[model samples]
Target: MKRWCALTKKKTVLLYLDRGGGAVGVCGGLFTATQKGQKAPETAEGAEARFTRWLQSEQLFSIILSSMSDLQEALAHRGSSPPSVISAARSGLSRLLDHLLDQSAGSFSGGASEWLKLGLSGRALDLKALVSALQQHFLLFSQRLHSAEVERRSLRLEVTNLRRGLQQGVPSDHFLSVCEELHQALSREQEAQTLIQDQSKQVRTLSHSTQELSQARKEVARKERSLRILGKHLSGVQKEKQQLEERLQRAEEGQRDLSRRHECVVNCLKSAETSCKQLCHACISRIGWLEQEVSAHRSHVTALRSELQDACLRDNQAFVPVEEFPEPFPPADPETPKPVPLS
Candidate 1:
């Protein structure tokens, strides 16, 4: 009997050979199954049985092939897949399929050395061709998987670099803006401080000026008081001077009046002296005249006495001649004659 099996892109064949021994040893071969063969099975029952077994094997083989393809595809697209683990799985699946096929053919060949000659029909299955095909497929699939993984890793790295660049670029502008704002704030604060200092200076100057003004006012008040006292003293002195002037005028008038009275008294004393001199001269002239009158009267009285004596002598001589003649008669009686002599 001859049978055929199909897997993904591969086809396998089995041949049953009857060896003459009572021990029925089995041998099988595999091919692409596209060509006609002389050993194609003749009995319908045997053909049907072989065809059914080939179908079952093809189904299982297809399942294993599909699972390998899926795993390779996943490895190609997913950067996180482990390459060593995928390689190990692929190797294990290939060896298992080879073992099952060899056992079904009742081959006891040991080691990979017998793998070169497949002993059924005294011909080999083309191991070099099979190894070449498997190697080509494995190399292509592994390359595609590695390339996809590289692309995935490169895309992720590029995204990360772009995000970092954007973040770093944005922060620089923000930092510059913050620095500018801080500079402006510092300038404003300095201006405010300068204004405050100027105001303080002005206040100090005003205070000094006010104190000076107060001192000036006090000096003015003091000056006014001094002037008032001086004025009062001046008025008192003027009154005293006027009183002294009046007293001096009165003393001068009294002195003039006294001088005039003294001159009048001197004139009256001179007039009285002239009158006394005239009265003394008149009294001296009267005494001289009285002395002259007494001398003249004494001379007259002496002359009268002498003249009376001469008259008495002449009268006696004339009476003696008569007396001589009468003497002779009177001598006769002396006593009686004394009386006669008196007669």
Candidate 2:
């Protein structure tokens, strides 16, 4: 009797099992409970907890399979309601299978094959295993999709930052051109300063030389004045020497006349002394007077000789040495006189 009851429980459990693409509706109440509870919750964590609860409830199919294995023991103690109970069990099993198949069919779309390639396939040997596998696949797929979206957003933000940096950087060629212009300007400034310094040095040297030239001109002017004074004095001395030379020549001529007269008187006295021995005394007195005049002229001639000698000595001392002039008078004669030449 236990064996018969066991065989009937097995048949009831088999009625709820999912064939490929089939419906099962016994677990529909649990999905309804989750949907109603999710209406007030807004956060991802709350939604995840609800989904976990739903998966756990779906695992109750395994417990139902175990209960069916003990149905034989339960049927043995029953009185007379076996047929009615078996009918109710069969109806409940049918409803459960119908609900599961309906839910699976609702999840499928025209692109169901593509979804399966992306690891969304839902195939299992039993209802419990199928629910567990589907739950795990859904959780992992949702997590991977969210992570991929976050990574794409981060990459876009980094690209924007790099573009801004490029806009702010300076151009290399323009900076180099500015540096070259500054260097050229500095070089020109240095050259101008050097030229100014050289000009200043040359001006100083020329000023010093000009000062020395002015001093030399003053000395030359002073020497010219001294020479003019000396020239005037020399002219005066020359005129005086000329006059003295004239006077000396005249005196020399007078002395020659006197000597000539004395000689004539001596010749006449010699001729008279012989011829007038017993002659008159008057003749003798006239001869004596002639001798007196001759003596006086001799004294005058001696004085004039001394004056000429003195003038010659002064000329030697005062005049510049030069060739002497020739004497201007002849020798004295007793009876004749010669004229003297003036200088």
Candidate 3:
């Protein structure tokens, strides 16, 4: 017995040493391994602890071994250990198997003290050997029972066929139904076998496929890296588009504002133009009235001048022409086309 290499479902090789100075292992979930030709450091405390653990584990493993050779091989690794201890371990294994399997515990002599001797005819009756013998017997019985059932079914088919050939033939519906069921079962089995063959074919090609898997992984990783880079580029492009869209929206708002201002300015100009037209009409009317007043005053001055000229003639004074007098303002025709004053 040696320190456990692993307490797992798979075999694990370790650089530990055992008494046999070689290797021994168990199958299906628990096994041990050690470094070849290597030995543990001799220390009292370490040896006691290792022995205790091994003692506990070995007794359990001995009960688990289905093969006599595996059991013998395991026992051989004990290598010059105390017989009393080995006997105690074997007895424990026997008792445990008896209890677990519900076998008669007293069938084998526990006090024989010769568990190390291998083979069925040996002085020590190994309990594992008895279990193996029982399993063989059970398998043989099952095979015989299966052959008997096949023969029985074959005879039933023949009887059914022969009855159907007779004049009074009336084939049993139950038998025919069973035969149909058997045919269906056979077809299903063939399909299952086909599926198994396909799986086996895949298994045969597994090494080549496994080799390709590494390259496939590399390709996948490279594709992932490229995808990541592309994603980053896409994100950047989207951000730029968003920024451009925002700027466009802002420009649209500014244009709307400008249009509103333009509309307001146009409305104001229209109102100002209408007011200017009204003021110009008023000023033209006032200028026309002033022109009429000036015309009347001119007429009065003309009459006075004529009268003065006659008086001057009577008194021997020189007459002056009305044209010689300077006009008080420019003529109305010129003033009529002049610009009006703004309010």
Candidate 4:
């Protein structure tokens, strides 16, 4: 088993040697030219690229050295190194170093005996392989470093642009404080907007109330006008009633005067009736006296008529006796006319 392990370790070292030999052949010409100061023909851009790559390679070498030391410390403290330590060490150097370290740790036995045997037999070979491996690693690190430098430059430009844009508007030192103040201002603005909305609602309510009050006042004014008209009508009616009362009073006074005149006319009619009765009695007595005088005159007229009739009859007898004695008497005067015979 120990023999098999030893063989495997040798094989791993041989493989690393082969790889290192190939890298030396490829980069040997360039390394020789730089040392002799016989710089290779290159453009300005190519020379600048080479210089940046060299600087990055130096930085990488330092990082690798730091990781190796950290790994050694971890091994001493814990008596065994964790996988992270091994990974850190492997990532820092080339794959060749990783293969060698992995084989030695995994396949070999521990202790002084194994160490002495490995050191005595392979020390010179290991030294030669290590030197070659370092050269190859340097070349690989340079290539990787060139690519890393280009990416870093691009990232640096982007970061510079971002920083400039931020500085144009606000200072980086107080950026957080400015943002906080802006947030507070926005909150206050929102509160003020809400208060304004509430005040608008109150104003609208007041306007509605004012309109209602105006309508009420109009209604009151209309009612006042109607009351004024009614009062005028009532006053006219009162005036008419007053005139009627005055006329009625005058009519009553006329009726009292007519009653007094009617009573005086009735008393005059009674006196006239009494005077007519007295006149009627006096006329009746005068008519009775006139009838008595008419009877006395008629008796006187009848006595006178008897006297005239006796005288006439006596005269007729005397004349008739004288006719019998007419031839015996003496004659008187011739001229005396004969007496008229009585009829």
Candidate 5:
């Protein structure tokens, strides 16, 4: 079956690795740079160029290109349509490259971070290369299977010839026993081949899982970066406003009393904290909003802390970056007198 186009709407790309009848593996994610709202919309060709440049994220880009070349040769040799396969490669290449950025941007923590050290081991073997190797391995197994079948057929023919020769002169027990041993040996060889194939399949499965783990680690890194940005803005907001800090402290004190009365709220804080991450808008201005809310109405202090926490997590959209300009300095006069050295 054909693996279709990788590019999708919402800045996402889906690249599937087909294993015979089914797609056993995939690697994909959103275009990280799509946050730019003011950029002009480009035509299809221009968009492809943009994706191509973005796909060159670190060293993985070159590795993917090499894999693509190797894959093209495999496809052509297998008698698949060259033009269609080539086009698929072209589209898929961009998708593969774009996903690399998402992988790197994600936060890898816990066991996922540990796996990165051993992930694919070195630069010599990329994901596509690994997939190609697996395909080749399957081909090798098929060849071995055919050889075993031929050998078994030859043994059966030999057994028939031996029985015919022995039938004319009463067959000796030793000759019959020897023929039984040949059949037994063929049976053992078939069993051994079966076992080897099973082990190889297990290895293939493990490799596919590692690829998935690597992609997931990258995704985690992306979210961590966002949370870090949120954290940074929260820190800036808290330090910038003294009034907000005092009000928040009072709210926290009240929350502590409320928590004692309704102990279940402590357990609910995990979900509340998750919601806190979502409220990363207008963080600095949130302080003024909280002050107004506290004045305008009497509400549960627990809810107040959640809002305050959200305010801390999001940065104000109005925060503009100040660009640094290099200051010009006049050059020294060529004939300036040198200072005397201390004796």
Candidate 6:
């Protein structure tokens, strides 16, 4: 039997020829009918693209139908006001196209083919009737879209004229008055800002002065503390001076006592010298008597020797200076010559 292949809008459908000379059921379950033997391999990406295209076509058909219904309703309510309805329909179409594009970019893994197969199962669907309805609605939608473009242009022209009127409509006097008021308000605001800046500067200056005062106060406190320390040192120095004065007074008293002792020793030496001179004179007189009588001198010499010993002991024992002795000794008289002391 001769086998042939046919492609359709939905998918690839496999048709087999039966031995009974009749067409059998389709394989692969695609919308496109083709011979079953030695089928070409369908790539995953190609299948996904086909599915996406089919979905977008169906969505376009639905959008056309919806737009037609809206147009019919709008025409019934407001006889010739088709611009609003047409714009609404255009917006809906745009959204539908966006949705279809999104679905085309989404995941199309292993199970997408199964979903396509299920979608192709008709269950009493009339594709021809759907195509006819889509054609009629699409024509109506196109005509309305053109009319809407014309109306949009007219609306843009009216808006431009209204803008021009607003720009050049007011009196020059009113505009000048508004400008003058704005200038006055701006001048007042600038003055207020200048005053605020001046006040802030004054506050900062005052704060700096306060800091300087605090530093001066601290210096004063430090000086006062130094003065207190100096006072304490001065008191200590005064006490040291008093102690030195007392030591000086005691040293002066000791010097005076040493002077009195020295004077006593000097006077004792002078009195002993006078006594020795007297003894020497007595010895010389005795020597002359002894020469005159040699036998008689022996007894006299013994008595004279005993008297000299007693005189010498008495002079040695004396420790006091003469109270009657003058400070400046009297000179010896020429009539009564003083005796020279023995060596």
Q: What's the count of clashing pairs in each model shown?
A: 0, 16, 0, 0, 7, 1
lDDT of 5 at 78: 69
TM-score of each: 0.26, 0.23, 0.32, 0.25, 0.22, 0.34
Across 1-343, the per-residue lDDT of candidate 5 in tens digits comes to 0122234442222554442333323332212222345334345566566556766665565667664774557575767677758655754564464344235335222223333433533323466865674675555446545644765687698689889777766457876887789889888988888888988888898898889888888988998998999999988887777668888899999988887857767666866776666555445356567656654544445456557655643433235333442332343223322333322
Candidate 4 lDDT tens digits, 222-340: 98898889889888888888888888888888887888777778777777778767666666665555555555655555565556556755666677675663343232222322332
Candidate number that wins on lDDT, 1 or 6: 6
Where does candidate 6 stray beyond 4 Å?
Answer: 1-162, 169-209, 246-296, 299-343
Q: Model-by-model lDDT, in order?
A: 0.57, 0.55, 0.58, 0.57, 0.56, 0.59
* Candidate 3 CA-lDDT value: 0.58
Error of model 6, residue 242, in angstroms: 3.6
Higher-TM-score candidate of 2 and 6: 6
**Residue lDDT tens for model 3, 180-226:** 99999999999999999999989878967987998899999999999
What candidate 2 gets wrong by more than 4 Å, as runs, is: 1-191, 245-343
Per-residue accuracy of model 6 over 43-162 as CA lDDT, tens digit each: 456766775797578666776566466555665775556676776566555545434433432432232454444454443235784465346445545645665676579779879988
Q: Candidate 1's error at 228, in angstroms?
A: 2.3
* Candidate 4 local distance difference test against the native: 0.57
Q: Which candidate number maximizes lDDT?
A: 6
- TM-score, predicted candidate 1 vs. hidden true structure: 0.26
265 Cα displacement, candidate 6 (Å) = 5.4
- Tell me the deviation in Å of residue 274 in model 6: 11
Candidate 2 overall lDDT versus native: 0.55
- Which candidate order results from sorting by TM-score in descending order? 6, 3, 1, 4, 2, 5
| lDDT per residue as tens, model 2, 44-132 | 45545666686678455664554353354445656638764674465345445445444555653322443444344232125565576
